[model samples]
Target: MSLQVQIMDEIKTAMRAKDTVALEALRAIKSEMLLAATASGSKEELTADDEVKLLQRLVKTRKESARIFTEQNRPDLAEPELAQVAVIEKFLPAQLSEEEVEAVVAKIIAETGASGIASMGKVMGLASAQLGGTAEGKTISAIVKKLLV
Candidate 1:
Protein backbone atom coordinates (compact mmCIF):
# COMPACT_ATOMS: atom_id res chain seq x y z
CA MET A 1 0.00 0.00 0.00
CA SER A 2 1.02 3.60 -0.51
CA LEU A 3 2.55 5.43 2.40
CA GLN A 4 -0.39 7.83 2.58
CA VAL A 5 -2.87 4.98 2.78
CA GLN A 6 -0.75 3.28 5.43
CA ILE A 7 -0.70 6.50 7.42
CA MET A 8 -4.47 6.84 7.14
CA ASP A 9 -4.96 3.33 8.38
CA GLU A 10 -2.65 3.96 11.31
CA ILE A 11 -4.54 7.14 12.13
CA LYS A 12 -7.73 5.13 12.46
CA THR A 13 -5.95 2.52 14.54
CA ALA A 14 -4.56 5.19 16.81
CA MET A 15 -7.98 6.73 17.25
CA ARG A 16 -9.52 3.37 18.12
CA ALA A 17 -6.75 2.77 20.63
CA LYS A 18 -7.13 6.28 22.08
CA ASP A 19 -3.55 7.14 21.13
CA THR A 20 -3.82 10.90 20.87
CA VAL A 21 -0.13 11.48 20.16
CA ALA A 22 -0.11 9.19 17.16
CA LEU A 23 -3.44 10.44 15.88
CA GLU A 24 -2.32 14.06 15.95
CA ALA A 25 1.00 13.24 14.29
CA LEU A 26 -0.67 11.28 11.50
CA ARG A 27 -3.12 14.11 10.89
CA ALA A 28 -0.24 16.56 10.67
CA ILE A 29 1.55 14.33 8.17
CA LYS A 30 -1.56 13.98 6.04
CA SER A 31 -2.03 17.73 6.09
CA GLU A 32 1.56 18.28 4.95
CA MET A 33 1.26 15.73 2.13
CA LEU A 34 -1.90 17.37 0.85
CA LEU A 35 -0.30 20.79 0.99
CA ALA A 36 2.76 19.64 -0.97
CA ALA A 37 0.67 17.90 -3.62
CA THR A 38 -1.55 20.94 -4.09
CA ALA A 39 1.29 23.44 -4.11
CA SER A 40 3.09 21.78 -7.00
CA GLY A 41 2.17 23.07 -10.49
CA SER A 42 1.17 19.67 -11.79
CA LYS A 43 -1.01 18.93 -8.75
CA GLU A 44 -0.07 15.29 -8.85
CA GLU A 45 -0.25 12.84 -5.98
CA LEU A 46 2.96 12.39 -4.00
CA THR A 47 5.11 9.36 -4.67
CA ALA A 48 6.36 7.17 -1.79
CA ASP A 49 9.74 8.87 -1.91
CA ASP A 50 8.01 12.23 -1.70
CA GLU A 51 6.07 11.06 1.34
CA VAL A 52 9.27 9.79 2.98
CA LYS A 53 11.05 13.06 2.33
CA LEU A 54 8.09 14.96 3.78
CA LEU A 55 8.10 12.81 6.89
CA GLN A 56 11.86 13.24 7.28
CA ARG A 57 11.54 17.01 6.93
CA LEU A 58 8.80 17.06 9.55
CA VAL A 59 10.87 15.02 12.00
CA LYS A 60 13.91 17.19 11.43
CA THR A 61 11.90 20.34 12.03
CA ARG A 62 10.49 18.94 15.24
CA LYS A 63 13.91 17.90 16.49
CA GLU A 64 15.35 21.31 15.81
CA SER A 65 12.39 22.95 17.51
CA ALA A 66 12.76 20.66 20.47
CA ARG A 67 16.45 21.51 20.75
CA ILE A 68 15.71 25.21 20.68
CA PHE A 69 12.97 24.83 23.25
CA THR A 70 15.21 22.83 25.53
CA GLU A 71 17.98 25.37 25.29
CA GLN A 72 15.54 28.00 26.53
CA ASN A 73 14.71 25.74 29.52
CA ARG A 74 11.19 25.03 28.27
CA PRO A 75 10.57 21.34 28.59
CA ASP A 76 6.85 22.03 28.25
CA LEU A 77 7.35 23.17 24.64
CA ALA A 78 9.96 20.56 23.83
CA GLU A 79 7.93 17.57 24.99
CA PRO A 80 5.28 17.84 22.30
CA GLU A 81 7.86 18.11 19.54
CA LEU A 82 9.58 15.00 20.83
CA ALA A 83 6.24 13.22 21.03
CA GLN A 84 5.50 14.09 17.43
CA VAL A 85 8.94 12.84 16.44
CA ALA A 86 8.22 9.49 18.00
CA VAL A 87 4.94 9.18 16.14
CA ILE A 88 6.39 10.30 12.81
CA GLU A 89 9.24 7.84 13.31
CA LYS A 90 6.87 4.91 13.29
CA PHE A 91 6.16 5.44 9.59
CA LEU A 92 9.79 5.73 8.59
CA PRO A 93 11.96 2.82 7.58
CA ALA A 94 14.35 1.65 10.28
CA GLN A 95 17.25 4.08 10.36
CA LEU A 96 20.74 2.88 9.60
CA SER A 97 23.10 2.69 12.53
CA GLU A 98 26.14 4.94 12.49
CA GLU A 99 28.44 2.03 11.85
CA GLU A 100 26.23 0.84 9.00
CA VAL A 101 26.11 4.29 7.41
CA GLU A 102 29.85 4.70 7.67
CA ALA A 103 30.41 1.33 6.14
CA VAL A 104 28.15 2.13 3.23
CA VAL A 105 29.72 5.54 2.70
CA ALA A 106 33.18 4.02 2.65
CA LYS A 107 32.16 1.48 0.04
CA ILE A 108 30.57 4.13 -2.13
CA ILE A 109 33.73 6.20 -1.98
CA ALA A 110 35.74 3.19 -3.00
CA GLU A 111 33.39 2.17 -5.82
CA THR A 112 33.32 5.67 -7.28
CA GLY A 113 37.10 6.14 -6.81
CA ALA A 114 36.48 9.28 -4.80
CA SER A 115 39.95 10.31 -3.59
CA GLY A 116 39.52 13.85 -2.43
CA ILE A 117 37.05 16.48 -1.26
CA ALA A 118 36.45 17.57 -4.85
CA SER A 119 34.66 14.28 -5.43
CA MET A 120 32.30 14.97 -2.52
CA GLY A 121 29.43 15.87 -4.78
CA LYS A 122 29.66 12.67 -6.76
CA VAL A 123 29.76 10.57 -3.60
CA MET A 124 26.91 12.48 -2.00
CA GLY A 125 24.73 12.17 -5.10
CA LEU A 126 24.95 8.38 -4.94
CA ALA A 127 24.59 8.22 -1.16
CA SER A 128 21.53 10.44 -1.08
CA ALA A 129 19.68 8.23 -3.52
CA GLN A 130 20.79 4.99 -1.86
CA LEU A 131 20.33 6.20 1.70
CA GLY A 132 17.12 8.14 1.45
CA GLY A 133 14.44 6.89 3.88
CA THR A 134 17.12 4.81 5.63
CA ALA A 135 19.32 7.63 6.92
CA GLU A 136 19.13 11.28 7.84
CA GLY A 137 20.62 13.63 5.26
CA LYS A 138 22.70 15.44 7.84
CA THR A 139 24.11 12.20 9.17
CA ILE A 140 24.89 10.97 5.67
CA SER A 141 26.49 14.29 4.77
CA ALA A 142 28.64 14.22 7.85
CA ILE A 143 29.78 10.70 7.09
CA VAL A 144 30.48 11.56 3.49
CA LYS A 145 32.47 14.62 4.53
CA LYS A 146 34.54 12.67 7.03
CA LEU A 147 35.27 9.94 4.50
CA LEU A 148 36.02 12.25 1.63
CA VAL A 149 38.37 14.43 3.62
Candidate 2:
Protein backbone atom coordinates (compact mmCIF):
# COMPACT_ATOMS: atom_id res chain seq x y z
CA MET A 1 0.00 0.00 0.00
CA SER A 2 1.11 3.56 -0.64
CA LEU A 3 2.39 5.44 2.38
CA GLN A 4 -0.47 7.90 2.17
CA VAL A 5 -3.12 5.18 2.19
CA GLN A 6 -1.46 3.44 5.10
CA ILE A 7 -1.30 6.76 6.95
CA MET A 8 -4.99 7.40 6.32
CA ASP A 9 -5.88 4.00 7.70
CA GLU A 10 -3.70 4.59 10.72
CA ILE A 11 -5.27 7.99 11.24
CA LYS A 12 -8.69 6.34 11.35
CA THR A 13 -7.43 3.77 13.84
CA ALA A 14 -5.86 6.48 15.98
CA MET A 15 -9.07 8.45 16.01
CA ARG A 16 -11.10 5.40 16.92
CA ALA A 17 -8.67 4.52 19.68
CA LYS A 18 -8.40 8.13 20.82
CA ASP A 19 -4.65 8.07 20.49
CA THR A 20 -3.92 11.79 20.32
CA VAL A 21 -0.18 11.47 19.80
CA ALA A 22 -0.49 9.20 16.79
CA LEU A 23 -3.36 11.20 15.35
CA GLU A 24 -1.27 14.37 15.56
CA ALA A 25 1.72 12.73 13.93
CA LEU A 26 -0.34 11.22 11.13
CA ARG A 27 -1.99 14.55 10.45
CA ALA A 28 1.39 16.25 10.26
CA ILE A 29 2.55 13.67 7.74
CA LYS A 30 -0.54 14.25 5.62
CA SER A 31 -0.06 18.00 5.77
CA GLU A 32 3.58 17.76 4.75
CA MET A 33 2.72 15.48 1.85
CA LEU A 34 0.09 17.87 0.64
CA LEU A 35 2.44 20.84 0.87
CA ALA A 36 5.15 18.96 -1.00
CA ALA A 37 2.76 17.92 -3.76
CA THR A 38 1.50 21.42 -4.32
CA ALA A 39 4.90 23.10 -3.93
CA SER A 40 5.76 22.23 -7.52
CA GLY A 41 2.88 24.42 -8.70
CA SER A 42 0.79 21.41 -9.73
CA LYS A 43 -0.81 18.51 -7.97
CA GLU A 44 1.14 15.29 -8.50
CA GLU A 45 1.72 12.17 -6.52
CA LEU A 46 5.09 11.93 -4.83
CA THR A 47 7.53 9.35 -6.11
CA ALA A 48 8.58 6.62 -3.68
CA ASP A 49 11.94 8.33 -3.24
CA ASP A 50 10.22 11.64 -2.59
CA GLU A 51 7.90 10.06 -0.06
CA VAL A 52 10.82 8.54 1.80
CA LYS A 53 12.64 11.86 1.82
CA LEU A 54 9.57 13.59 3.18
CA LEU A 55 9.17 11.06 5.97
CA GLN A 56 12.84 11.27 6.85
CA ARG A 57 12.62 15.04 7.01
CA LEU A 58 9.67 14.80 9.37
CA VAL A 59 11.43 12.32 11.62
CA LYS A 60 14.57 14.41 11.66
CA THR A 61 12.64 17.52 12.55
CA ARG A 62 10.95 15.89 15.51
CA LYS A 63 14.16 14.37 16.73
CA GLU A 64 15.92 17.69 16.61
CA SER A 65 13.07 19.32 18.47
CA ALA A 66 13.17 16.60 21.08
CA ARG A 67 16.88 17.06 21.48
CA ILE A 68 16.47 20.74 22.06
CA PHE A 69 13.68 20.20 24.52
CA THR A 70 15.73 17.69 26.44
CA GLU A 71 18.74 19.96 26.48
CA GLN A 72 16.50 22.62 27.98
CA ASN A 73 15.39 20.12 30.62
CA ARG A 74 11.90 19.84 29.34
CA PRO A 75 11.14 16.15 29.10
CA ASP A 76 7.50 17.02 29.26
CA LEU A 77 7.76 18.63 25.81
CA ALA A 78 10.34 16.23 24.43
CA GLU A 79 8.34 13.10 25.09
CA PRO A 80 5.55 14.04 22.71
CA GLU A 81 8.00 14.99 19.97
CA LEU A 82 9.67 11.63 20.32
CA ALA A 83 6.31 9.90 20.33
CA GLN A 84 5.44 11.70 17.10
CA VAL A 85 8.77 10.64 15.63
CA ALA A 86 7.98 6.99 16.37
CA VAL A 87 4.63 7.31 14.66
CA ILE A 88 6.13 8.98 11.59
CA GLU A 89 8.96 6.48 11.37
CA LYS A 90 6.53 3.58 10.93
CA PHE A 91 6.17 4.64 7.30
CA LEU A 92 9.88 4.74 6.56
CA PRO A 93 11.94 1.87 5.18
CA ALA A 94 14.04 -0.04 7.68
CA GLN A 95 17.28 1.82 8.34
CA LEU A 96 20.68 0.22 7.88
CA SER A 97 23.04 -0.34 10.78
CA GLU A 98 26.27 1.64 11.13
CA GLU A 99 28.40 -1.42 10.42
CA GLU A 100 26.40 -2.16 7.28
CA VAL A 101 26.72 1.44 6.18
CA GLU A 102 30.44 1.34 6.81
CA ALA A 103 30.81 -1.83 4.71
CA VAL A 104 28.86 -0.27 1.85
CA VAL A 105 31.00 2.89 2.02
CA ALA A 106 34.15 0.80 1.93
CA LYS A 107 32.90 -1.05 -1.11
CA ILE A 108 32.03 2.18 -2.91
CA ILE A 109 35.40 3.72 -2.14
CA ALA A 110 37.14 0.65 -3.47
CA GLU A 111 34.98 0.53 -6.58
CA THR A 112 35.64 4.15 -7.46
CA GLY A 113 39.32 4.08 -6.46
CA ALA A 114 38.61 7.17 -4.41
CA SER A 115 41.27 7.98 -1.83
CA GLY A 116 41.74 10.87 0.55
CA ILE A 117 39.21 13.52 1.49
CA ALA A 118 39.58 15.11 -1.95
CA SER A 119 37.59 12.23 -3.37
CA MET A 120 35.06 12.40 -0.56
CA GLY A 121 32.56 14.09 -2.88
CA LYS A 122 32.86 11.35 -5.49
CA VAL A 123 32.44 8.57 -2.94
CA MET A 124 29.56 10.32 -1.18
CA GLY A 125 27.51 10.77 -4.36
CA LEU A 126 27.84 7.12 -5.32
CA ALA A 127 27.25 5.89 -1.79
CA SER A 128 24.17 8.05 -1.29
CA ALA A 129 22.70 6.80 -4.55
CA GLN A 130 23.50 3.20 -3.69
CA LEU A 131 22.27 3.49 -0.10
CA GLY A 132 19.18 5.48 -1.05
CA GLY A 133 16.82 5.82 1.91
CA THR A 134 18.22 2.85 3.80
CA ALA A 135 20.97 4.93 5.40
CA GLU A 136 20.90 8.45 6.66
CA GLY A 137 23.11 10.97 4.84
CA LYS A 138 24.98 11.90 8.01
CA THR A 139 25.84 8.27 8.68
CA ILE A 140 26.97 7.76 5.09
CA SER A 141 29.08 10.91 5.22
CA ALA A 142 30.68 9.87 8.48
CA ILE A 143 31.53 6.44 7.14
CA VAL A 144 32.88 7.90 3.91
CA LYS A 145 35.06 10.28 5.91
CA LYS A 146 36.38 7.51 8.12
CA LEU A 147 37.13 5.28 5.13
CA LEU A 148 38.66 8.05 3.06
CA VAL A 149 40.84 9.42 5.83
Candidate 3:
Protein backbone atom coordinates (compact mmCIF):
# COMPACT_ATOMS: atom_id res chain seq x y z
CA MET A 1 0.00 0.00 0.00
CA SER A 2 1.00 3.60 -0.46
CA LEU A 3 2.41 5.51 2.50
CA GLN A 4 -0.70 7.66 2.67
CA VAL A 5 -2.97 4.66 2.93
CA GLN A 6 -0.73 3.08 5.57
CA ILE A 7 -0.76 6.32 7.54
CA MET A 8 -4.52 6.56 7.35
CA ASP A 9 -4.87 3.02 8.67
CA GLU A 10 -2.50 3.83 11.49
CA ILE A 11 -4.44 6.94 12.31
CA LYS A 12 -7.58 4.91 12.82
CA THR A 13 -5.70 2.38 14.91
CA ALA A 14 -4.24 5.11 17.05
CA MET A 15 -7.62 6.62 17.58
CA ARG A 16 -9.05 3.26 18.59
CA ALA A 17 -6.16 2.62 20.97
CA LYS A 18 -6.42 6.07 22.48
CA ASP A 19 -2.82 6.87 21.60
CA THR A 20 -2.84 10.63 21.72
CA VAL A 21 0.77 11.07 20.60
CA ALA A 22 0.48 8.74 17.64
CA LEU A 23 -2.87 10.19 16.69
CA GLU A 24 -1.51 13.70 16.70
CA ALA A 25 1.57 12.73 14.72
CA LEU A 26 -0.46 10.76 12.15
CA ARG A 27 -2.84 13.68 11.64
CA ALA A 28 0.09 15.99 11.03
CA ILE A 29 1.44 13.57 8.43
CA LYS A 30 -1.94 13.37 6.72
CA SER A 31 -2.19 17.15 6.65
CA GLU A 32 1.26 17.52 5.16
CA MET A 33 0.59 14.88 2.50
CA LEU A 34 -2.69 16.59 1.53
CA LEU A 35 -0.94 19.93 1.27
CA ALA A 36 1.78 18.47 -0.88
CA ALA A 37 -0.71 16.80 -3.16
CA THR A 38 -2.72 19.99 -3.58
CA ALA A 39 0.15 22.45 -3.78
CA SER A 40 0.21 24.68 -6.85
CA GLY A 41 1.78 22.98 -9.88
CA SER A 42 2.37 19.82 -7.87
CA LYS A 43 1.80 16.28 -9.08
CA GLU A 44 -1.18 14.26 -7.97
CA GLU A 45 0.96 12.04 -5.75
CA LEU A 46 4.41 12.00 -4.25
CA THR A 47 6.94 9.45 -5.33
CA ALA A 48 8.43 7.00 -2.80
CA ASP A 49 11.56 9.13 -2.50
CA ASP A 50 9.48 12.24 -1.99
CA GLU A 51 7.53 10.54 0.77
CA VAL A 52 10.72 9.56 2.54
CA LYS A 53 12.09 13.06 2.21
CA LEU A 54 8.88 14.51 3.62
CA LEU A 55 9.02 12.17 6.64
CA GLN A 56 12.67 13.01 7.16
CA ARG A 57 11.89 16.71 7.17
CA LEU A 58 9.18 16.18 9.77
CA VAL A 59 11.55 14.22 11.99
CA LYS A 60 14.26 16.84 11.63
CA THR A 61 11.88 19.61 12.57
CA ARG A 62 10.79 17.75 15.69
CA LYS A 63 14.36 17.02 16.70
CA GLU A 64 15.34 20.65 16.30
CA SER A 65 12.39 21.78 18.36
CA ALA A 66 13.26 19.26 21.04
CA ARG A 67 16.84 20.47 21.05
CA ILE A 68 15.74 24.06 21.51
CA PHE A 69 13.37 23.10 24.29
CA THR A 70 16.10 21.21 26.07
CA GLU A 71 18.50 24.11 25.68
CA GLN A 72 15.91 26.29 27.39
CA ASN A 73 15.60 23.66 30.17
CA ARG A 74 11.98 22.92 29.41
CA PRO A 75 11.60 19.16 29.53
CA ASP A 76 7.83 19.42 29.43
CA LEU A 77 7.85 21.14 26.07
CA ALA A 78 10.57 18.89 24.71
CA GLU A 79 8.82 15.68 25.65
CA PRO A 80 5.96 16.00 23.19
CA GLU A 81 8.23 16.90 20.32
CA LEU A 82 10.42 13.93 21.03
CA ALA A 83 7.39 11.74 21.32
CA GLN A 84 6.19 12.87 17.92
CA VAL A 85 9.63 12.13 16.55
CA ALA A 86 9.30 8.60 17.81
CA VAL A 87 5.90 8.18 16.20
CA ILE A 88 6.97 9.64 12.89
CA GLU A 89 10.10 7.50 12.85
CA LYS A 90 8.04 4.34 12.73
CA PHE A 91 7.14 5.10 9.11
CA LEU A 92 10.66 5.89 7.99
CA PRO A 93 13.15 3.26 6.93
CA ALA A 94 15.54 2.29 9.69
CA GLN A 95 18.25 4.91 10.03
CA LEU A 96 21.91 4.24 9.42
CA SER A 97 24.08 4.18 12.48
CA GLU A 98 26.98 6.64 12.60
CA GLU A 99 29.37 3.86 11.77
CA GLU A 100 27.21 2.76 8.84
CA VAL A 101 27.00 6.32 7.59
CA GLU A 102 30.73 6.75 7.86
CA ALA A 103 31.24 3.55 5.89
CA VAL A 104 28.95 4.76 3.11
CA VAL A 105 30.54 8.18 3.07
CA ALA A 106 33.97 6.59 2.82
CA LYS A 107 32.79 4.53 -0.13
CA ILE A 108 31.27 7.55 -1.86
CA ILE A 109 34.39 9.60 -1.29
CA ALA A 110 36.42 6.81 -2.82
CA GLU A 111 34.06 6.48 -5.76
CA THR A 112 34.01 10.23 -6.37
CA GLY A 113 37.79 10.53 -6.01
CA ALA A 114 37.16 13.49 -3.74
CA SER A 115 40.20 14.98 -2.06
CA GLY A 116 40.43 17.60 0.64
CA ILE A 117 37.73 20.09 1.58
CA ALA A 118 37.79 21.48 -1.94
CA SER A 119 35.93 18.41 -3.19
CA MET A 120 33.52 18.31 -0.28
CA GLY A 121 30.60 19.47 -2.38
CA LYS A 122 31.01 16.75 -4.98
CA VAL A 123 31.33 14.09 -2.31
CA MET A 124 28.31 15.42 -0.42
CA GLY A 125 26.09 15.52 -3.48
CA LEU A 126 26.93 11.95 -4.37
CA ALA A 127 26.66 10.76 -0.78
CA SER A 128 23.35 12.46 -0.18
CA ALA A 129 21.85 10.85 -3.27
CA GLN A 130 23.18 7.44 -2.32
CA LEU A 131 22.35 7.65 1.35
CA GLY A 132 19.26 9.80 1.43
CA GLY A 133 16.61 8.84 4.03
CA THR A 134 18.94 6.27 5.59
CA ALA A 135 21.19 9.00 7.02
CA GLU A 136 20.85 12.55 8.22
CA GLY A 137 22.55 15.27 6.16
CA LYS A 138 24.41 16.63 9.17
CA THR A 139 25.88 13.25 9.94
CA ILE A 140 26.82 12.69 6.32
CA SER A 141 28.40 16.15 6.05
CA ALA A 142 30.39 15.69 9.25
CA ILE A 143 31.65 12.33 8.07
CA VAL A 144 32.61 13.79 4.70
CA LYS A 145 34.44 16.67 6.35
CA LYS A 146 36.31 14.36 8.72
CA LEU A 147 37.28 12.02 5.90
CA LEU A 148 38.25 14.78 3.49
CA VAL A 149 40.29 16.66 6.05
Candidate 4:
Protein backbone atom coordinates (compact mmCIF):
# COMPACT_ATOMS: atom_id res chain seq x y z
CA MET A 1 0.00 0.00 0.00
CA SER A 2 1.07 3.58 -0.55
CA LEU A 3 2.45 5.44 2.44
CA GLN A 4 -0.46 7.84 2.24
CA VAL A 5 -3.00 5.06 2.52
CA GLN A 6 -1.07 3.48 5.38
CA ILE A 7 -0.86 6.81 7.21
CA MET A 8 -4.60 7.29 6.83
CA ASP A 9 -5.29 3.89 8.29
CA GLU A 10 -3.00 4.60 11.22
CA ILE A 11 -4.64 7.99 11.70
CA LYS A 12 -8.01 6.32 12.03
CA THR A 13 -6.63 3.84 14.55
CA ALA A 14 -4.95 6.56 16.59
CA MET A 15 -8.15 8.60 16.70
CA ARG A 16 -10.13 5.59 17.85
CA ALA A 17 -7.59 4.76 20.54
CA LYS A 18 -7.31 8.41 21.65
CA ASP A 19 -3.55 8.30 21.17
CA THR A 20 -2.78 12.00 20.87
CA VAL A 21 0.94 11.53 20.35
CA ALA A 22 0.46 9.16 17.46
CA LEU A 23 -2.40 11.14 16.03
CA GLU A 24 -0.29 14.30 15.99
CA ALA A 25 2.70 12.54 14.50
CA LEU A 26 0.66 10.90 11.79
CA ARG A 27 -0.98 14.21 10.95
CA ALA A 28 2.43 15.82 10.62
CA ILE A 29 3.48 13.09 8.23
CA LYS A 30 0.34 13.55 6.18
CA SER A 31 0.85 17.32 6.10
CA GLU A 32 4.42 16.98 4.93
CA MET A 33 3.49 14.44 2.27
CA LEU A 34 0.73 16.67 1.02
CA LEU A 35 3.09 19.63 0.82
CA ALA A 36 5.60 17.56 -1.12
CA ALA A 37 2.96 16.37 -3.55
CA THR A 38 1.59 19.84 -4.15
CA ALA A 39 4.82 21.77 -4.28
CA SER A 40 5.00 23.85 -7.44
CA GLY A 41 6.33 21.95 -10.44
CA SER A 42 6.62 18.79 -8.35
CA LYS A 43 5.25 15.43 -9.33
CA GLU A 44 1.77 14.53 -8.10
CA GLU A 45 3.04 11.60 -6.04
CA LEU A 46 6.25 10.80 -4.21
CA THR A 47 8.26 7.70 -4.94
CA ALA A 48 8.98 5.26 -2.09
CA ASP A 49 12.45 6.71 -1.68
CA ASP A 50 11.07 10.24 -1.42
CA GLU A 51 8.58 9.18 1.22
CA VAL A 52 11.29 7.55 3.33
CA LYS A 53 13.47 10.63 3.09
CA LEU A 54 10.56 12.81 4.18
CA LEU A 55 9.82 10.58 7.16
CA GLN A 56 13.48 10.57 8.17
CA ARG A 57 13.58 14.33 8.00
CA LEU A 58 10.59 14.56 10.33
CA VAL A 59 12.13 12.15 12.83
CA LYS A 60 15.45 13.96 12.73
CA THR A 61 13.82 17.32 13.31
CA ARG A 62 11.87 16.09 16.34
CA LYS A 63 14.92 14.38 17.82
CA GLU A 64 16.99 17.50 17.45
CA SER A 65 14.28 19.56 19.09
CA ALA A 66 14.05 17.09 21.96
CA ARG A 67 17.80 17.22 22.46
CA ILE A 68 17.76 20.97 22.65
CA PHE A 69 14.86 20.92 25.06
CA THR A 70 16.67 18.44 27.27
CA GLU A 71 19.80 20.55 27.26
CA GLN A 72 17.73 23.48 28.46
CA ASN A 73 16.35 21.36 31.32
CA ARG A 74 12.88 21.14 29.90
CA PRO A 75 11.72 17.55 30.15
CA ASP A 76 8.12 18.63 29.80
CA LEU A 77 8.87 20.00 26.32
CA ALA A 78 11.30 17.28 25.36
CA GLU A 79 9.07 14.40 26.32
CA PRO A 80 6.41 15.04 23.72
CA GLU A 81 9.01 15.52 20.99
CA LEU A 82 10.51 12.15 21.86
CA ALA A 83 7.10 10.54 22.03
CA GLN A 84 6.37 11.91 18.58
CA VAL A 85 9.68 10.53 17.40
CA ALA A 86 8.61 7.07 18.55
CA VAL A 87 5.39 7.54 16.63
CA ILE A 88 7.09 8.83 13.47
CA GLU A 89 9.74 6.14 13.54
CA LYS A 90 7.15 3.41 13.22
CA PHE A 91 6.97 4.40 9.55
CA LEU A 92 10.71 4.25 8.95
CA PRO A 93 12.59 1.17 7.83
CA ALA A 94 14.20 -0.67 10.73
CA GLN A 95 17.51 1.09 11.32
CA LEU A 96 20.77 -0.78 10.93
CA SER A 97 22.78 -1.19 14.09
CA GLU A 98 26.06 0.72 14.28
CA GLU A 99 27.95 -2.56 14.11
CA GLU A 100 26.04 -3.55 11.00
CA VAL A 101 26.72 -0.15 9.49
CA GLU A 102 30.39 -0.46 10.37
CA ALA A 103 30.66 -3.84 8.68
CA VAL A 104 29.04 -2.53 5.52
CA VAL A 105 31.29 0.52 5.52
CA ALA A 106 34.31 -1.71 5.91
CA LYS A 107 33.25 -3.81 2.94
CA ILE A 108 32.55 -0.76 0.81
CA ILE A 109 35.90 0.75 1.70
CA ALA A 110 37.64 -2.46 0.75
CA GLU A 111 35.70 -2.80 -2.49
CA THR A 112 36.47 0.75 -3.55
CA GLY A 113 40.08 0.61 -2.34
CA ALA A 114 39.21 3.75 -0.37
CA SER A 115 42.03 4.54 2.01
CA GLY A 116 42.71 7.54 4.20
CA ILE A 117 40.44 10.59 4.62
CA ALA A 118 41.19 11.63 1.06
CA SER A 119 38.80 8.99 -0.27
CA MET A 120 36.12 9.78 2.31
CA GLY A 121 33.76 11.46 -0.11
CA LYS A 122 33.82 8.61 -2.59
CA VAL A 123 33.27 6.07 0.15
CA MET A 124 30.50 8.12 1.73
CA GLY A 125 28.61 8.46 -1.54
CA LEU A 126 28.75 4.74 -2.19
CA ALA A 127 27.90 3.78 1.38
CA SER A 128 24.94 6.18 1.56
CA ALA A 129 23.58 4.83 -1.72
CA GLN A 130 24.07 1.27 -0.57
CA LEU A 131 22.54 1.74 2.86
CA GLY A 132 19.75 4.08 1.78
CA GLY A 133 17.22 4.74 4.59
CA THR A 134 18.55 1.89 6.71
CA ALA A 135 21.26 4.10 8.25
CA GLU A 136 21.52 7.76 9.11
CA GLY A 137 24.12 9.90 7.36
CA LYS A 138 25.91 10.81 10.59
CA THR A 139 26.32 7.17 11.58
CA ILE A 140 27.57 6.24 8.11
CA SER A 141 29.98 9.19 8.03
CA ALA A 142 31.42 8.32 11.44
CA ILE A 143 31.90 4.70 10.38
CA VAL A 144 33.49 5.72 7.10
CA LYS A 145 35.90 8.03 8.91
CA LYS A 146 36.79 5.30 11.39
CA LEU A 147 37.38 2.73 8.64
CA LEU A 148 39.25 5.04 6.31
CA VAL A 149 41.54 6.65 8.83
| Backbone clash count, each prediction separately | 0, 0, 0, 0
lDDT of 2 by residue, 63-148 (tens): 99999999999999999999999998888999999999999999888888999999999999999999999999999999999898
Q: Higher-lDDT candidate among 1 and 4? A: 4
Best by lDDT: 4
| Pairs that clash in candidate 4 | none
How does candidate 3 fare on TM-score?
0.96
Candidate 3 lDDT, 81-108, residue by residue in tens? 9999999999999999999999998998
**TM-score of predicted model 2?**
0.97
Whole-model Cα lDDT of every candidate shown, in order: 0.91, 0.93, 0.92, 0.95
Compose the digit string of candidate 1's lDDT tens values, residues 11-115: 989999999878888999999988999895844788778888999999999999999999999999999899999999988889999899999999999898998
Where does candidate 2 clash, by residue pair?
A: none
What would the TM-score be for candidate 4 when compared with the true structure?
Answer: 0.97
Worst 10 residues of 1 by lDDT: 40-49
RMSD of 3: 1.0
Worst 10 residues of 2 by lDDT: 37-46
